[model samples]
Target: MPGIRKSLLQLVFSGTSMRRWNDKMRPMELMEVDKQAHKMIMAWMLYMLNGSDLDRKDFIDLGDKIVLGGMYDYLYRLVITDIKPPVFYQIKANPAHYQQLTQWVLEQLKPRLQSLGDPFWKGMREYYADGASRDDLASRILDAAHLLASQWEFHLIKDLNPKDEEMDEIEANFIQGIEGFQDLIGVRELMQGNKASLGRFAQLCGQLRFQQRWSQTPRIPETAVLGHMFIVACYGYFFTLMVGGCKARRVNNFFAGLFHDVPELLTRDIISPVKSSVKRIGDLIKEYEFKELDSKIFRTLEQGGYFELSRRLKYFLGVDVGSEFASTICLEGDTREVEWDQLQTIYNNDDCDPKDGFMLKICDDLAAFIEAYTATRNGITNDQLQQALWKIRKKYQQVSLTETMHIGGLLADFD
Candidate 1:
């Protein structure tokens, strides 16, 4: 079950949420970027499968092609929708309001959509025509999202590398999780199903492993997002397991660890100090990111009618535009028991337990230390890496986050 959830969450973050902008403002390749966005949309689909029945009823009613295609189309629309002021957030995309949207997507993804001219895509095109029901178009978009998301390679996107037998076990769980649905899950093709786009997507996800983090830095044995996430996930998993985290708690922590840094795909890895340093300026950046995510990510999920994923992402990332610390802000310092308990009362639906959240933070810090240690071992002798390692050792040597953590040994074992 955990493996299935991990695989699904991995798909969502697999796609970079938006196109990378350069110094001169020329756009980067859409294949990788678009793939990441599409995967995130698919993340919502996976979430639906993992979530409650009521949450899935909307898409289930619309039928399969629409469910798969419409999710893609609907989630994909978020990328195309321009980021305007918060005032525009209230305006939902209705059929009457989106003729231009249809025109734009057709222009961009025309070949891919056209090549795989399924009935769902046809319905989406029909919705743009006069008097056609938006309902059909909406469903088709979800279908498109699922189809596009299907074009993925888990090995590429996920930080995991399972053994053959382990993979077989995971696959069985993945299949058995949704009765009558395993056959539907696969890599889809734009030209047709003859070629293996799913396999290609897996390769793309695999390449993400090599996409270096902090490229500007003089790093040794450079830490990639792939390894970082995997280590953090393991740390969280083991820590949660040791602390007696509940089933839901473990899943939440594992997922949170897996996806906590996904926003770096767009923002590059803006260090926490920079985000929190300049008071109002950091607030402004946070504000901008919230708006952008809504436009570039959440809006698609919302319109495609996947609310659960939206809420979950906001909670884990702490970017909720609606609330102070997004959904998971733990008020600074009382005691772990009080703060964790308080969080439960505050956000009843949050998937990550308060304990899981704390454990994730601890593991996150530990992973940062591991990165520095690994980099230095690889011959990265920069003062930045040196200071990073020193500061982490100094701070964590005497811990206060929770009594359950064996922080000293955790770091030592990694060393």
Candidate 2:
């Protein structure tokens, strides 16, 4: 696990300057964070659109390739930088650096691309040769990349006062852009013109798009909201083989891991140490999450045939959407393996655990470990993060209760 994370951290987002925040009048971030957002959003779209006569294996594979392709498009967009583009801009353009970053991304993604059949490369070669006879799929992918990057501006300025006209305009532009780009992916057709669900989704995007994780720790390069989403999704995919061989189950668990933090989208990412410091306060925070989900997030989307969407998301997240086997998700590790059949039965019954929840927990904790470990590696002398490491290791050693997302080989694999 650590080996995989080390490769990803050092190679995938390896920009020359990744310092989180400073006094520059204009902030510039590499598109790595937005790449994460685009991938997750695409996963979600495919998740919603699955079972429409598509083989589950093919569907998952195609979704991965599409997201990676969109990321490639994101890199190519950096082939040129404007002093003031509508979305991302460069006060100082660095073409060589951008090219280097693009090559790094290509190297990381090459394996995934090669695994897909050869026609994808054929499309690539033809498009490169003709220059004008580009594939429609590529254009839509570019559109997806732009959508994620453009809306990410919300995350950047989330600290601004909500009443600020700039925020209002940003929100307006996002809403309007989605409305206009319905043709790009035919996504609106999937929504069935349910403006109510779409409206609530826009609000949900705003809620999560700006919410930062690990806020208490002093990070050398601060983590953003969407960047962590990508991490969780990537971890989900990594663990897919460890649990089982069911194709749909693999995909299901991957998404379960993806939305595990979706509740934090509503309630901000509170540190677990703070939550555990006081039992009553922790319980209070959980109660607040339920209340907010009910009042703000869920109710708004419940009527749009998306009531099922709400239920499935909450099931994955272990929120108030209600499942009888929610407690089973908390059951210990190997226990889940033995009772796996029963869990699957319960899953179909909707009174049960997500087939992937237990594995999801492990991957989620692994993500926490990497976040803390990487910060320390980057020379951030943060006691909070240091303690985070000790506490995580200590708890993993002490706990036999449910294997609680801590893998035995994790520290063994650490650098």
Candidate 3:
């Protein structure tokens, strides 16, 4: 009964409607509750942003004090219950109720909306009408935050126009490097590749740990996948030091990590749960994905004639871009028809050692888990880390227990 009541409350607040309540409640009470709920949701969102670094227990403590706790439970139920919008729209048929709800939402959001700049306000204004789904909300939020943070980066850049020609050239090379890849990846428009914008992306990537799922730990901030690539590249360098320091191996490791997930540009980050769930439905989805990748994502990159970009990525990683080694390095796991032993024999025959690539995988998982731990510290409960660790441990049994323990300890420290 409590759960049902709570669900009804959430439906009312989330612009959904209940038939029974519409007929029974007084207009004044409905309007008052709706207004309060709107304010409460906004306040909770702000709190989540501000106290994002609080630990799980502390976050729960704060959330309990705020309206977010209720909102969280409510949204979760709505998602699980698979409630239909038509039911809500029926309640919206009540003209007074509809007007009151709209007015309340607008009034509550007004201050925050006005505080944002014109560009941001324009985007927000179009967001609802544009049919922006709930999934796109996170990306849009990150984009908006990046836009806001760019003002500071711009000011910082203005102070750094060096007079030295060589220095200028070096700076130009960095810009060119980023732009070159941007075009190749077809993310040029999305990222803009400007110093301020790149800086914002990097910062947000670190802040949000976008590479990671949500956690009860505090999040780092919103970070672009490009930023994660950079971190992985750096980790690859360190990984080389830990193992025998081979120049070629190090280069390969870095490049592999850099371009490993570039296809995500086309697919967006397909969350693992969704991917695994679709497994039961067989290869239909995979076939569709492959077609989508070839037609939409890969075509865009190919049009940029960025084969050289691919070469550079492979060159730095010391692998043949067209080789099976390259495929394994770029794509996680083998999708081929070969058996495990056969695949191993193929790698052995080709002399394409899996060591460096495997290490890079470890680094990737480490960075991701660390990001999750940080998110959990911030006030998010992210069970994804535990799930991932379990999965990886099972998947990479060949990985030394010592190495696994070391990586696990490193991640656990963040907790």
**For this target, which candidate reaches the highest lDDT against the unseen true structure?**
2
- The runs of at least 3 residues in candidate 3 whose Cα sits more than 4 Å from the true structure, single-residue gaps closed, are 1-222, 280-293, 296-305, 311-355, 382-398, 401-415
Q: What RMSD does each model have against the real structure?
A: 18.8, 8.2, 22.2
Estimate, for each residue in 116-194, the C-alpha lDDT of model 3 and write its tens digit: 2343334344433322232332332322332323322333333344443444443454455344333122234324423
**lDDT tens string, model 2, 1-415?**
1123334333333321232222212234434453445445543653444423455455555544454454345333333222134323231134554445445545555454433235434443333343333344434544543555455544564564455556666577667766755654335532332354644454465345455567766775566565665556555544443333244444456566556666676778888777889868877887887778777667766755556566656656566423212323423222223244444444432222235554555556666777777778889877788787777676565433223223554554566
Model 3 clash tally? 29
Give all TM-scores, in the order shown. 0.50, 0.62, 0.38
Q: Could you give me the TM-score of model 1 versus the true structure?
A: 0.50
Better model by TM-score: candidate 1 vs candidate 3: 1
TM-score of 3: 0.38
Candidate 1 residue-wise lDDT, 1-415, digit = tens: 1111222222232333333211112222333333433443344344443334433333333323333343344334444545441212223335544555556666665444442234435654655564224344334344344334432333232234343344454345333433333333331222132243333322333344445666667764455564455445545644554444444444455556656655554455677667778868676766676777667556655564546656666665655333222224333321123244444344323232343455577777776765676667767788777787777777777664346444654454445
Residue 253, model 2, lDDT: 60
Clashing residue pairs found in predicted model 2: 362-405
* Model 2 TM-score on a 0 to 1 scale: 0.62
lDDT of 2 at 166: 65
Q: All candidates' lDDT scores?
A: 0.46, 0.50, 0.38
The candidates, ranked best first by TM-score, are 2, 1, 3
Tell me the deviation in Å of residue 96 in model 1.
61
